[model samples]
Structures are given as C-alpha cells and as structure tokens.
Target: MSLSQQQELRAILEKGLPHAAQPYLLIAQALNTTEAQVLAQIQLWQEDSLIKRFGLVVKHRKLGFKANAMVVWNIADEQVDDVAAQLSSCSEVSLCYRRPRRLPDWPYNLFCMIHGTDREIVTAQIDAMVKKFSLSYVEKDILFSFKAYKQQGARYTKQGI
Candidate 1:
C-alpha cells in the first residue's frame, strides 16, 4: 500500500471498526475506496505480519462474566508447553500463556485466565482443571480481577511509520 493509504488505514484502525453489519464496507465508503480494495490491503498487511490479530474485543463483565481470575502455575520447565496447551484447550480457560519465572520469589510460569458469572464458579473450574491435570502438588496462585478499565486498539501515527 502507498504511504497515504497506510496512514488512512492506521487512522481508521485507531478508531476501531464500526459495530455494524458491513463495517468494512462502511469503512471503505468513509475512506473513499472500494470494500474489496480495503479488504485486500488488510489481507496483505496480515500476510506481511503488520496485523498480529483481528477480532472482537468483548467486554466480559457486560456479558455477565463478573468473576475472573488469573491462575498462575509453577510447572516444570519441560512441562510448561504441554501444560499450557492443556489449559488452552479447557472450556473455562479464556486465555493461556507462558512467562518467565522470577526465581527465588515468583516461580510461576504458566498462566491462564478463567472467567465466570460468580466467584465460586471460577473457583470450581480452577479446581476441576487442577484435578484433571493432576496438579494437586503444583504450586499455583489465583489473582481475581476487581475492576476493568476501558479497552482500545493500538494507536499508530504516520510519524511512527
């Protein structure tokens, strides 16, 4: 895409796509371009690794998921990947990732987020996960979320290009 087109795309993305039936078509009209052209450019950008992810950002609380917790586990280094995959497959797990452990203080590495309408439900899901994974002996922690701030897409500027 040309520099001007890139700038326009970035601007549109910063404001986020419209919540309409034909968001891309609306965006195309607003940008004075065809919907197919806009979609082609977006696909090209994805192929070029410019866009890491493209999906809806749901408001969990608004969807009646009031209780959420980040469950961190200190699994063996060799088992982290397998455990992450297992947790990622669970229906209760909203997100799963692996992070380095802060040794001697924080030893947790694998992390998963669980969400539910009630705290007890979240806890029960966590318990089920532990039992299913035979993680009774695994060191873990649950940090519940108390608040959620506003969510927004990344802001890109022409100067940053």
Candidate 2:
C-alpha cells in the first residue's frame, strides 16, 4: 500500500519464495493485506519489467534429473520464432531462448535446455523434438552438461531493486 510496504515485499521476494504451502498468503498476512493485492503487485512489477527475471531455479540434480543437455541450434532466421515457440511449449524443455550468433566461430543462435533422468532419456527427448516439430536446423548440437553450478534467485537489498 505504501512505499515502505512495497520495499518489504521486494525484500521477501528477493530472498526467494517462502517455504510454505501458501507462501503468498503468508506474505499478504504479514503486510496486513489480501492475497489478491500481493499477487496484483507482483503482476504489476512483472508488467513494468521492474524485475529482470522472476522464476524458480529448480535444482534438477536434487530432483533426480541427472541428465541435462543444452541443445544449440542454428535455425533459419525466418523460422526460428516458430521453432522456438514450439520448443518452449514442450514439457520436456525447461528453458528455450535465442541468442545472437557469433560468426566465424559459434553459429548457433537458438538454444534450449532439456533435462531427464538419464542420458538416454535426454537424448531421446531431443530427437523427439526434432522429429515432432520438424525443426529444420541448419546445424544442431547436443551439449550434455558434465557439471551444474549453484542457482539462486535475484537479490533484493534493503535499498530495494
């Protein structure tokens, strides 16, 4: 409701989600506001792009997803959008995005990360995606990850973002 309260909300969000069944409800109660208000504020922040990224960073290995591959694709400039959209829609795909290709070296522009329980599972998922979507990639590489680094959400300081 007030500037101080909004900063408090941001602080809570930056520390990562509350480990509760109804995390939002807890936050709203603490702010002496309704759950809807809290959600609305978050929505407004997202719409305004106040936060660059607001999503859970799942520890795939801890969840038994041992296999993960970053599928690098050199998709056609014209068809990349459609292909990326389709890839993003797949449940198997955890992340999909486009990056500028570095010519004379790295040529892949489109990227998607697929996770599974095993190497075979991840490989099959990639193969299935290529077949199911008929992704006519000029070049494709399945870069299986050998290691995973720590993942954390954005940090909201007392000064606020």
Instruction: Give per-model TM-scores.
Output: 0.80, 0.75
Model 2: colliding residue pairs? none
lDDT per prediction?
Answer: 0.86, 0.86
Best-fitting candidate, measured by TM-score?
Answer: 1
**Model 2, residue 103: what's the lDDT?**
93
68: Cα error in model 2, Å:
0.8
Error of 2 at 46 (Å): 7.7
Q: Global CA lDDT of candidate 2, please?
A: 0.86
- lDDT by residue for model 1 over 42-144, one digit each (tens)? 8988999998777777877899998989999999999998888888999899789899999899999988999899999999999998999898999999999
| lDDT of model 1 at position 113 | 92
Report the lDDT tens digits of candidate 2 across residue range 20-85: 999999999988888999998998898899966667777878999888899999988888899899
Question: Model 1, which residues run further than 4 Å from truth?
Answer: 20-22, 29-32, 45-54, 153-161
